[model samples]
Target chain A: MASARSDRRISADHIPVKLVIAGPFGVGKTTIVGALSEIEPLNTEEVLTQAGTLVDDLTGVNEKTTTTTAIDFGRLTLPGVVLYLFGAPGQTRFQVLWDELVRGALGVLVLADTRRIDDSFAVLDLVENAGIRYAVAVNHFPDSPQYPPEALRQALDLDPRTPLLVCDARDPASARASLIALVEHIRELVLS
Target chain B: MTSGRQRRRVVPDYMAAARLSVPEHISVERTTLVSIAADADAGGLDPPASHLLALLRDEPLSVYECAAHLGLPYCVVRLLVAGLVGNGTLLTRDPPPSDLPDIEILELVLSGLRAL
Candidate 1:
């Protein structure tokens, strides 16, 4: 499957909608891409080393090896649309790559882990600073407290227009709904 | 394959900015343009995305050319293009990439030079 994707990328005819999946470490960016992508996702990842302990937060994700280095690339087809999803790695060290992942994106789906919502503030800030519209999704961890949308909004200080929702990340249907909200939000921004 | 209109871009002005940044006059060349979806992790990408994929399947188009054709605002277009290039969907043989936030660059350069 990976080899097949290699050839397809070279074909000079496949245009992809570039969507960025951003959140803090272990917020399920790679896993979501893997679940939704029609093609075998391409990940540029390296396992975390002991040296990384100084920088990467290892609080909840002691087991995450092979953290994405550059981006996690996936292909998903939505009816007539072919979405090329790029899951941005969570580490602050790789913020250099954020601009690339952002290109051609019409909107953003920012995942926030309720257990570590604090970690997400910076990612949300980056997206907001870029001036492109975005929506927030709370990736519900087993331990993450389920808060009302309004409470989450106040916690995140989200703009009234920003769509705030929750998802399991493991569920395909729920994930799809979140993306649909993003598209709608983009349309609203454009029209306004 | 020729491109087709799926829907109108809200702001062609964004594409215009991206097109102006490029130093080329090609009527058409393949370029990697970005499409942002809201809940990609949850799966809500736009419908026109297929057209976008078909547009970038092969070669890297100049920022200049994409804007003129797509008619999006240049600033918005540039933002998207920069992000896509960052993601490795496109490449430029010249100038490498300059999307490093200007502040970060200044700090890196200043720090390096001072250390030297």
Candidate 2:
């Protein structure tokens, strides 16, 4: 009976996977991770005092108070599968730290606030520079006018094979759907 | 509102460099940060050093503690501390508190975080 149980556990070992949520400053990378995680999320946050404004970019996140300093982490478990979610550090200067964060992640979910689309480019470039597979989630802001998906694709210069979808970072259902799209994209990569 | 000019006085590079020197065994270069700040602020304090000085005001903490106080990481602190200490605003004693465990210190940090 012990041997049988051990064999069953061994088969279950590889069920869960890791997914990363990455984006630029103030783009809700942590919010998306928290919304989907089954467990209480752990994040390292620091107040974005006036001092940071001089050093880090403050174009879109002008009114921001705090930002992730280290990583924000959460977990989502499925039937015999667990998805570990990690939120990347939000500053461009912190780009050097990504290799360690993305080490074992299966794929990345790149969040973009349509109000400030250019901010997303830094994150997308980092993922591409690292040669990891990623999908983009355009988190809608209330005032952001809708635009054609293809136009956004061209604007961001996204590859044809990369998945791009709309999401409301504040809504769990919408965030979950975006993550599912990322999972499906990764699976498709495997199949190909 | 932001001021275009920062306050600068008569502080020479050698004096700035001598005071900021850290005797710690850590791999950080305390002197290089001063030159960068001198270059950027045109011989005035760079904005990031203000954040680091606030952290150093309390104690000769590790690179990690400075990061926590600023809501940043050792990466940010390492850069800023090297500059401030090199410029004589703060002093760094490196080689760190030895590898030997200090149970009391661990409990104090945990207690501090809990209190926070």
TM-score of chain A of each: 0.84, 0.84
TM-score of each: 0.57, 0.56
Off by over 4 Å in 2: A1-16, A45-53, B1-116
DockQ (model 1, Cα): 0.04
lDDT of 2 by residue, A136-170 (tens): 98888777768899989988899999999999888
For model 2 the TM-score comes to: 0.56
Clash totals, every prediction:
58, 6
Clashes of 2: 6
> B1-116 in candidate 1: lDDT tens per residue?
11243124533443334433342332221124333332223133222222233454443333433443344433344554554444444443221122322333223322322222
Instruction: Enumerate the candidates' DockQ scores in order.
Output: 0.04, 0.02
Model 2 clash pairs are A16-A82, B20-B85, B24-B94, B24-B95, B25-B94, B25-B95
DockQ top scorer: 1
RMSD to the hidden true structure, all candidates:
17.2, 15.5
